[model samples]
Target chain A: MNNKVALVAWREYVVRVRRRTFIVATLLTPIGIGLLALMAGYFSTKGAVSSKDILFVDESTIFRSADPTSETHVFRFSDKNISEERDNYLENHDVLVHIPPFENLGDKKHQVQYFSEEKLSVMTINKLERAIAKAFKNHKIKSSDIDMEMYNSFDTKVVFEDGEVLEKIAAGEEDASKSGKLNLIIGTILGATMGFLMYMVIFIYGGMVMRSVMEEKINRIVEVMISSVKPFQLMLGKILGVGAVGITQLAIWLILIPVILWIVQSTVGLNDASQAEQMAEIAQNMNGQTSLEGFDIGQIISEFQSLNWGLIIPLFVLFFFGGYFIYSSMFAAIGSAIGDDMGEGQQLMIPIVIPVVIAFVMLQGVLSNPNGSMAIFGSLFPLFSPIIMPARLAFDPPMWQIALSVVILILSCIFFVWFSGKIYRVGILLYGKKVSFKELGKWLFYKA
Target chain B: MSVLQISDVVKQYGDHRAVDGMSFNVPKGSIFGLLGPNGAGKTSLIRIITRITGADSGDILLDGTPIQKTRVRDIGYMPEERGLYKKMKVGEQLMYLAQLKELSASEAKKVINHWMDKFDISDWWNKKIEELSKGMQQKIQFIATVMHEPSLIILDEPFTGLDPINTNLIKEEIFRMNDEGTSIIFSTHRMEQVEEICKDIVLINQGKKMLEGKVSEVKQKFKENIYELIYLEGELKNDSTYTIVQNDGQKASLKIKDGLRANTVLQSLIQQGIQIRKFEEQLPSLNDIFISLIENKTV
Candidate 1:
């Protein structure tokens, strides 16, 4: 933070922040995400509310007393023959379901024909099949004289139980199981979002730093600046400056996205009755049920509130900066080594790009098993920790592992910055030379 | 007193020595020429003086103290491959560079205004560097170099893209700055400007000093004892005292023999009844000396 370095940093930050492209990108991102959410909400709501009315030609005689209505379909038993209904059902009903008569009730190969003018949606088809199968089971159960109460009791579900939740339940905590389920969902969502976000910022802002360095070199302004200040100072100033830009954009997005989403939800979620119904249906689906009794927006909000924001938020900031610094310094080195030919730098970029790509590719696996061996190793390894460790943060991994990862990441950031400064010192003054990895290695050892 | 001094500097790049055991001095308030062919280590030595790159083994002193980071304020270097941020405004770019030299914001603004006014480029204050013509850009760059008013200024090939008028304008400014007691190191291969403005020079080749002295003294050291004569009568011919290097009907050039006086040659010409209209000794131009020295054809 010397005076000259600070001056250079201020220049770098101001120049980029004032660019038209930066302004457009910063403003458009939240709008784009808002639009995407609107589209998804619109489509899901439309699909869920488009109810189908069915004419059931029950030739098998088993579904004659079946339930008349389900979540998305209304069924009516018809007395007409199959040919009569098939030709006239389109005038009133949306579909004609003709169940074939069979002597054996348990035969798996019995065919049922469905006739519709338009292609039926996958959800509609699956629901119809399930309704017909349920009718057959009921008929067969009545004929065999099975006890209805005992049969109802046989529908058992397997619930996932973690050791901590089991201990809480033993300690007389009745809502422990409910909170555990919510934690699983929230952890997966938070980890994936955070991991992906870290991956993206490293590439986006790191590339910004690289291109800015290359621009200075190409413009040949670096030599004049170098004469006034050390190369290390210049490089550090640029990284910090562009890093500030990244943080600024992130802060804006954090505020703008929620506001925009709230506006969209109020407009699209409140005015449309069908969208409210669709959200209730999705909540029921998440609870693995077909009834809307479990749909509670307040409970979902409480679940979100239950997260350990005090730990997660600060760790996220630390990892975000650590990852950005580590990758950007190397990017600055590659940019300096590129010379006048822009294409020549691609080969040197492979080493830096590989780790980030690997971290992103491994994100899914880490989310599935946050405390597994792969997740543990990936989270502690300095190169991958910025991405993987933040992803595991929501899972509440062991405190010792988190501490170790943070320490390693901070140290690596310092090392890489110093290392890249060495390469940048020699490379900025070099022109028209195709620099290679070997050349960069030699420059790393060069005297300042 | 010398404003800057270098002693036995050696800078090696792998197997090749870019600056090999070089030494020189820039006297206070003098315009000095650093003359060398391309790749002759003139830039290497300049970078060392500017402290852009450290010399592998050497001692560089500014005002009798070893050069350090703080000394950057005392030296303004406009490198040969120099440029300004094209997208940056002329005034802001000047302010940024001024601040790097530790100028306060208020001081920088006042100095920038004075320079822009002095150069009559006040209208270009808000214009980006890329918007200016090449000569105009060069003028702005020259102003940036001197706006800090450093005790020493190093300009490498400062006049490459300037038009004749701008070049003269810059030349006048250089003379003015020197008269105000700034030590200037002018580096270029253009020998004519060196002959016109430089009081002393160091000519180097292959990273080694080949010749160093006052401009007139070096030209005298390379003189060939040749004389040009114009006359109205009599003919000239080779004799025991002098040889006719070239001859026309009215003018002749002669080279005196070793250890022979110009008076003796003149007497011989008089005895031949040559009525001399003009007679003057010829000294070599710097360009000729530079070529002969680089080509190693003459001492």
Candidate 2:
């Protein structure tokens, strides 16, 4: 490094690192977020599935008695007088279901009622509904006097073009939808966290660079600084210095997140052991009950693990820095041109801030359909691509799109750096008057 | 020997010409004054000398070599728009600037300590610039500018914001530095200070050199052959030989025409029976010369 640039960079890095606000914000915020993630993970995995007891009373003499028990519920049948049934019957059972007798075998009128001490879970209610539907179908068959064997032959399964392909695709879509819910929620959280950080890091540090330039310009230290070092070096040094601070903060958070998560996971793991015992007892008592078909929590977890992190992570770092460099250079130029007036600096920031703001807004649209036109445009647009592209990585977009977005982003970054450098050289010395955009346009044509 | 030279430097900003074919030289070990009114391109010329901004069409020679980017390290430039980072501590800010001038860390620290003690601001080393008064910050800036001990030092209105005591202190230091063989370029509109310190001066107006010579010679060139006389008895009469510019009962000033001697006027005044208490030839002050030159440009 040139000694002058190193010196300027070092000063910027040290001064910001020493600030209490930087230290507190960098360290405490991640720990807080980690704790929140910990709580969410713990609750989701700890005893969320439910089991219940159901009592069945059959008063009808026209039909044979049937037994229906599921893994998530136990059914106990009884023949009791209707007058003996009390309102407080739930003290012993979770649910009491009654089927009233019909006056004639051919009568279609029948009444049923269910009483539960607590509101039944959706899964438990769905299981009961399916069991009732099968019983009714059996009763209807008996009344029709159909031959059981002949009727059984008519219960044929219609096969599609290929069962394997249908099953595989259905399973794939199912896993996708399941894991999609899993990954997207997790992805959105992670993406939003990282995106918010990227937004703040770029905006805050870019503002810092701007303010630093303005400070030097206002104080007229820039003139003395320029005499010893080129304006480009000064701007680069500040960008690098402030950038290093941001990277340092991010690195600390990166390390803290996993460490805190591990602690939380271990704590939750201990609770899962006791929960397993209770679940096993419920499974034993409710024998023959169907388990939730196809939507295995384990499979969803493995899908989360299978994400292409190798590609996503490296790309994230690249875009984070590339985006930061692009915005901060323009901010530095604006700072230089603003001279001593702070109000004009803010007014000028609109141009610099608009692209990033639009990127974040487009991020919302991308979340709904990662393959949508808006998503593709946001991912490809150099200004929005840094934030949008990384978010789309969870959706596994085509490799060519990622590569193209990256190429455009890198090229745009280089162009902006050179462009801002031109303005920075002349703007630092300007004073008294606010610089308009027209003047900056003229500066672009000046000879190096 | 000239330590620095500028030949035909021109800088144009849009349709306006900021520096138009200006030229000057700074003799080695002399205190040179760069004088101009506001908006007369004094800053543009200084910026070019410091290499802060490049000249549109010209060359500047420093120590007989053409000025390059690296040559700025040997020249200390303190501009009129002086400032320091208000949040930075005095010691650290100075260290950063001194190191930018290519001084080693230990050497910079040693020199910084020496200057802080010299300026009596050693106690402010750890204090943020905002904690110090404005004059104190100026002192720190001055220290930072000179800490590397450059061969050529340029100060633009260095004493503007300072109180009288601090101003005198800086003036003494400027003189002391010049005496030790460092060429100094002092730019200011305050001609009195320029008269006291600078030996050679270049007065610029509207981006062009209006006057360039030694202070003594420039004043001599502008002399109008005016003389002031004070007597206790009578007033000298105005005539073709000498015109009484101003007169009172006992005091008068007269202008001699056609290369007439002051002795002739004195002898004539005595013949008029005026008891001569004080009789001396008067020279125009730098203030008068600067005003006349710039006003001449406007006219």
Candidate 3:
């Protein structure tokens, strides 16, 4: 039996892997995911490029007294009419830029008229506005006795451990990029993405398994197949075949997404700085206020560092396979009986598919109320729990609740397998006959 | 030793009796045709013997022991409705079926390849079954059935969809398998094929055996001492003493009534200045007897 079952499994895997559909799915997944990653990199993320630059043209009656660079500039002219200098400046610069003349003193709504050969970044926009505002301020400051650079106010970030202030890093120095919040956001996103992947694979790919079984059974090919293997063995072989195909697709996606995303990021970074500057300039341009006073790094670290991965991954994998098999096996059996052809197979599919669809529907609710009665009770149902329970558990769910759900899911899967096997054995052989629930019941209970 | 012994088996589908106490024995090394029409309990009997479906009563013996579910592995059954997984390759499907019948991998491949060559379908090995023509599909289905070399082979209308050329190809293989000591029970509505190949035969109509015996003996049991005669203008020189059955001058056929010896009639014609261009005995064909028996039962 062991050898035979292995042969059946090996045969199923090899044949399906050689199929055109499987080959297309395997190759297309990586390319699709890579494209998705590239697209995502283009929008808003850490490594994406910015596209705009603005040239400061602060011509005001107010006297200017400040330093300048490409990032921060003040329009300083030797003559009162420096319009000739602007022509020379425009001729020398190669960058596509926005040129806003700072003239209107106290406009309430639209302050300054700006012109751009292209779009501008928030950082450059803010710097240009500050330079012009400073020219107006300089005349007032010159009238008084204050020096401008002496009044440069710099903002400071505060750190706290639990409730007390931390004067220095553990390494006895502070790092330039304070990335604790960024790390927290990325980590949370990764955890949620992983959980969603499992839920999606089970709910979607399990349907694919059912459709494949329906294809074979509708054509009456499963009759020849069942004669050789026990109905249980055939069901196992099919589920495993789908698993192998799915993992192959996932493997391709895993390899290509990072590689394509890297390329897209590098490509976009080469030419555009406006978009990239906008993201970083959010710290000051919008609100000009960011305070991390008395912020505890310990809690952020503890939220992630103290996470128990020993509990989640193994349980998730177990429930995923168990749930996938149970749903797909039921589909195989029901698909076989609906009709002796593909058209009729779909009629039966709509009803059988309701469970997986309902499971997906409850996923949002699971996320919203991980411990709500609907979420908790739904996590105990075999079909829905595979998707919902693992997800709720991703965010530090109670160990006992997860354990109980897994136990219930595992037990129900065993019963479903037995029930489906009986249906598959009898259903695969019946041909040219209309099948009903009543008729299927007869086949299931009728003793031979 | 007999390869299969089906004794007093009964199968019912609801109130309808599919096999009414049918019993038979298949001696080893013979092509036994279980003859019947579309719904005449032939499939029901085949299912019981193959252990695909069980009998409501009575028992089946395999080599003198009562057959069990596990014993089904020893019986190779090719059903009337042929099936092959369309997206699956011919070689792969056959190999899987071979393993299902308990053949070791190497043995299964060797046998599958051998049969593939024998059927002239080695080129079809890697091709998907759906790509093959119906005749080619039937050949692949046949290979799947017989690849394991089970001792008992049961085929139900195995030649249903094949063209004449492919039909003859499978026909010879069936004979070859039987000659090599495989006990085969061939079921078909094509009585000509059954008549040409089967030695011992069983005829069932309306869920009951109408007749069962060696082909010659069963033909004799349905004898009417009748002969259909065909004669040209130069041949029919006879007349007044013999009653003319149905005679048109260009074409004539007659059934020899009882007490009429064929040779005596021929001599009488020879003496009567008549010519006997064609002389033949009208033996009952399996088709003739099948139609007559079925027609009788319904009436």
Best by lDDT: 1
TM-score of predicted chain B, candidate 3 = 0.90
How does residue A329 of candidate 1 score in lDDT? 97
**A181-279 per-residue lDDT for model 3 (tens digits):** 433343344344655786678656776667766676666666566555656777777777777767766777778677766676686562345333543
| Model 3 global lDDT (CA atoms, 0 to 1) | 0.68
* Per-prediction TM-score to the true structure, in the order listed: 0.90, 0.79, 0.78
Off by over 4 Å in 1: A47-81, A91-94, A99-111, A131-158, A165-179, A269-297, B297-299
The digit string of per-residue lDDT tens for model 1 on A357-438 reads 9999999988888899999999998889999999998787999999999999999999999999999989998888888788
Model 2 agreement with the true structure over B155-256: per-residue lDDT tens digits: 999998899999999999998999999999999999899999999999898899888889999988999999888889865678666998898876677899
Q: Is candidate 1 or candidate 2 better by TM-score?
A: 1
Window of ten residues with lowest summed lDDT in model 3 chain B: B233-242
> Counting only residues 3 or more apart in sequence or on different chains, how many pairs clash (N, Cα, C under 3 Å) in candidate 3?
8
Give TM-score, chain B, model 2: 0.96
Off by over 4 Å in 3: A43-50, A53-191, A259-305, A338-341, A434-443, A446-448, B8-21, B54-58, B69-73, B86-90, B117-132, B229-244, B248-280
Error of 2 at B237 (Å): 2.7
Judge candidate 2 at residue A98 and give its lDDT.
78
Write down the lDDT of every candidate, Cα atoms only.
0.86, 0.80, 0.68
Q: Report chain A TM-scores, every model.
A: 0.85, 0.63, 0.68
Give the DockQ ranking, best first.
Answer: 1, 2, 3
